[model samples]
Target: MTRPSDHDHAPAPAALSADGGRADPAAPPGAPPGHPRRWAGLAVLSASLLLIVMDITILNVALPALSADLRPDSVQLLWIVDVYSLVVSGLLVTVAALGDRFGRRLMLVAGFAVFGVASAAVLLADGPGDVIAVRALLGVGGAMIMPSTLSMIRHLFTDPRERATALGVWAATAAVGSAIGPIVGGALLEHFSWQSAFLVNVPVMVVAIAAGLWLLPESRAARPGRWDAVGTVLSIAGMVALVYAIKHFGKEGFDDPGALVAALVAAVALPAFVVWCLRIPHPILEIRLFRRRAFSAGAVAALCTSLAVAAVLLLLAQWMQLVEGYGPLEAGVRLLPAAVGAVIASPAAPALAARIGARAVLSGGLVVSAAGYLVIAFGPRPLSYATVAVALLLVGAGMGSLAIASAVIMVGAPPEKSGSAAAVDETSYELGAALGVAVLGSVAAAAYRGDLPASWLAERGVTGATAAEARESIGNAMEIAAHAGTAGAELAARAQAAFTTSLEGASLAGGVLLLVAGVLVWVLAPRDLDVSGSSHH
Candidate 1:
């Protein structure tokens, strides 16, 4: 009759302390059974790694164009852009644990196959419904890809230093993937159709699938736990509700009925799920992991970084093309400095951490990021592309360093829980991005309203109900008002001004968050980088 919590259990070393420190447990006292195929395996794994990361943000540059072509209503467009992340966030923990239960390489190869077919589905989609369905399926594939890669790395490299170096490379590829999404999408959209963006994934996925089959080594859970169906449902439902709630708050504030309902549902469900986790004999995600200080710190940092930078690519794409009138490709080309900076800085992070301490490097990077945000926030009324690019490079540098924080979490976690740990990290990253778009974008919308002239609505031929509706969709409204003669011209100017002010406010808020995160990291992250067996390779 006794509950699970009543069961006597010996805690892990980290679990016994207040700070909940980690212990190295990946490699046994004896050396790992060395695989002669390690080199080819690592290469194949890394290459396959790039595609999953790339898919996460590659569609951003094409969103505006896609919106026009599809003529989706406001909600539909947001889903078209956000469903991928939302689904990915909700399923990461479940999928990661599944990979651990099944086999990492097997899951990875299966993931590639699923991702390829999903990408093809996206390419062939003729309507919004089709695209959305395909995108959701892509998320399923992505959930499989993410944890498998990290867990495979854990099994592949036994030496902590080599593992750290390999993770740095892995982290760099992730950063590069985010950067490449826009550039590749921009180029493909400019020269070909929007479908080409999805199409490009096909070839990359094919390569990964083939390479994985040939070169990747197989590994799975050393001691697997039973899948917790109840926990899985609660986690996914709670996440979906929470994201919807957050999005609702951004769009309609605290008072909106939809927001209220969603928030309440999430509040109840998430806590209930946590209780369920503590009670379950085998939870899908080990809730006890958060008790680790390093894991907790890393999770917070990851979320903060993504929240602060989520709007960067999207807003920048708008700043470059919509406000400045640069073509998609031209805008992406101009943004290359930041991409270059991120790529260069990403690889150098572990080395930097070794010298200055992970705490110092991460904290310093956050502070630098705050500075970048301020530069963008207070820049000239009609922003200069060059100035924005410079600020973006600083932002990129900040992000580059932030990427290493994952290594901290992974290395700090017990190797037995590597897949779950990585899954948690990836989930935080995805959640941050989704929340950033929803919250920051809302802030921008509010600022736009305040900046607009009273006459602006009348000028655009949007009066009464139409004007109220138009206010809800500044982008679409502005586009419609742009070609309406003198009145349209005035409306366009007002819309532009509104959007600019909104952006400025969002940037300022982001700046403050970045600074706070810096302080937190400096104060909370452990001084020593003694992550060994605790982290997966």
Candidate 2:
């Protein structure tokens, strides 16, 4: 990571109470931006973020076509799906460190070049291995590009308030990318080959490169010491293992030997890496940043917000498609309310943070988001689109608190250390998303199984083994029902009812979890905290 200059020391704990946060609490709202070119730079940054975020989901819709063309085995297909994230998660801290030591602009441009070239190469992929290789390359490009954009934003907007506002716009990109990826992928696949999915990134990367070169400024740590190569390796291994375990746990549960092994390695390696960072003179990242209330509070807010969004969004998507019988495209379109809410809330947050303080905004937003979940939980049976739309909007608005989360992270650290801070913030987001699926999904599954009629089904041929298999998932349950003849229809109808009830319980639990998180943040964050300027008190 970026080496700290003498002046780049961590903000003193004592000075924090009086010196840091807000330009001035008594002052009126909204400060001007840090630089004349910062907005233009933000456009470039947003595009980069959009591409990286979109890549994560765009592949989901194209998977069937990808399988048809490449004819990947099931195992190969799983690898193809898992490898990109594993590679990206592995390389994040390493790339962020390189971005700080080497110029962030240089690394970003290089990332764009790699991404463009790798995307274009997909046209030549005739087999699963070829596509897997391309995905790995794209992951490297993503790791390089993602942190560069965030750190660059830290440099681009020096004023804490302006930076917070800029970050809000940046945070909205996540919502927008999720909302758009399916639509864009669907449109592309309708008229072109599946390769078009990858090929599309080429032109966008080109535009991003040209704009980045023109609009972005170069930045790096001023006095970076000897690079910690060992720490880099440890971080890569630890994160890769952690993410693999998380993804595996979400899909196959915790019993798999591979997942257990990965989780063990991650649990061991991560703490060792932390200890390594603490002992070293010029560490990979300042792990101590977590000690600060603003930083920790914001990180918690970001994580919990992501957990709520990811888990609820999964259930909501299934409800809209499977339960409500909407087409895939229609369900995706209906979910756009969340994106719209985020777009509005993101840019508006800095002013709000300026007025009531970021602590309140962060905590308050989570509570509001929880209210949305409550609406989902207790709304009239057979879900209503109007009610869901309103709920999605609230969820999105609450997630807009991520703007404050980003600010607390970046503002709490020195500009030169932006890469490390960005990596931490980004990791929190990814981990939260994964955990949300694993935890809430497991909860929902239990509720579904519990609500199912057990003894009645056992008397039929659908006893023991068959019933056990059906209870595995809603999709499996429906599939089993479809071929079970007359008796199965009743089972299928009941399964649907049970699944819907599970969603209610899951939504309620998720809402309560978010409320608890909001309370924790309310206690952890300070009331007078300000990010109006540099917070290195």
Candidate 3:
């Protein structure tokens, strides 16, 4: 099978124009000949996406340095880490709608400028509050950039086949960015301040802004009706509440009052938002798109894949750093198998889907990921790095199906609704990741605590506050063990074993979840679905 090259010179389908309507063959001289620089524009969009995705993970490596400099309390530290995601989730729908109403290129350029300015501003961040503010600003920029990239791609690549290949490159870039964030952050922090983790975005954004303006074409919804302020408010409230509640639940469990209240807000606001969108002629989001089986299946595939992978990847990173005593950079490099697998598989997924059905590729990817998780869960005792590497490779390969998911989603919607389609697609990813970390992370925490019971801790003179801290997480347990006398070695060893057990339990749960998701997607997605065309069926 020949792979589609970036220089695909296929003519646009005569039946479908750039706007997903019938083309006019009798057009007069100098009619819009479509963007000649579209492939170059895609490169700019991918670069923007890489930076935005990288920002999400790079902070993990910078947190220690930032915390030591600012000496923030626990709550402040959590905010520093989480505020970015919260802001991004909240603003995604609203920002995407604005991009459609205004121009996607304009939104994207402004986003680049904002991201650059915010990163440079980190130099003046002396307190936890200042850092949190910068992170929130960066989230705003990320929200503006994320959906624009997808919607712009829909406009740029009118040919479904070319769009699929472009999306494949987009997905591959995202995977690489996410995997390498920590490596980049670690490298920066070793030589410069923690601020360097952020400041690095400045130069890249500068170049992206220039390239984007030069290479990207301006596009927006042709018939964008009046703005829905109520929908905007509800969307912001619902997404923020939903994400905050999930994070709170992950940290404090389901019984926390704050989490419950946030969940209530999400439940109320999201339903109201949906109803409002259905009523409005020009809804902030095209909620009706979910009625399409292909679109819905694509969203489910994105959500479940992210749900199954996020927590496991996070835990593996922690396992490398905390249990194996690898430095941040070393741990990041060890985590690269998934990235390597994704990079190799993503670009090939579109071609594979073209040969096999889209449904097969999407559902099969999830099955492959399930196998990866099951390998970790049921692999031999005392799992080695080699086993983990193999599992990561499988999971990464499975992630390549996301390119098909994106294609199905974009092609399923009309060109005018691309912003909404992009927003929904990205929302699935954000919400799925939050759900994964909350649910599976909680399961892991429970398993860890169950293994290190209070009674068992007391028997080892690790009672009261110290025992509670040990029960909380392996990181805390290791810290306590470091200060303990001779018994510290035994305690550390037991904690490590317990953490390993918890990881296995979580892997089992994630594996089962992925298997269920795979079956559901297979059932939901049409057997004859062709992603290389605009028609859903």
Q: Model 3, 1-537: lDDT tens per residue?
A: 001112222222221113323333443345444477888898999988888878866776665557546765434544675566567766777887788789999999999999999999999988989998998899889888887887788678765445545655676678878788879876777789888989999999999999998999899988666777898899878877876676567556789999999999999999999999999887877899988888788888888887777678767866776678777677778878887777777767767777887889999999998888999999987977888899988888888655567667765666656657767777777666656766687777778888888898788888988888777767677777888888799888888989888888999999999999899888888888776553654
Give the Cα lDDT of each candidate.
Answer: 0.68, 0.71, 0.76
Q: How are the candidates ranked when ordered by TM-score, highest leading?
A: 1, 3, 2
Per-residue lDDT of 60-175 in model 2, one digit per residue for the tens?
Answer: 55665575466554335445655665566567777877887889999999999999999999988899899989998997898788778877877886654455445555666766
Clashes of each: 8, 2, 0
Worst 10 residues of 1 by lDDT: 1-10
Q: Which window of ten consecutive residues has the lowest lDDT sum in model 3?
A: 1-10
**Could you give the C-alpha RMSD of every candidate to the true structure, in order shown?**
6.9, 6.8, 5.1
Ranking by lDDT: 3, 2, 1
Colliding pairs, model 2:
21-530, 22-530
Show the lowest summed lDDT stretch of 10 residues, model 2: 1-10
Q: Which sections of candidate 3 miss by over 4 Å?
A: 1-31, 34-40, 60-83, 120-133, 153-168, 189-195, 210-220, 250-254, 414-416, 454-469
On a 0 to 100 scale, what is the lDDT of residue 23 in model 2?
51
lDDT of 1 by residue, 1-537 (tens): 000010011122122112212223543467554356765676777776666655655676776576556655544555666677777777877777777788888888888998899989875677777888888898888777776776776677664434444555566566666667677778888888777878898888888888888877788877877878888788778777776776566656689898788788888888989999877766776778887777777777788888777765666666566667777777767777666767767656656766776777777878887888888888775767767877888888887776566656666577666556666777888777767766676676666666764466775576775565446545555666666567776666666666666777888989999898888876667777533222222
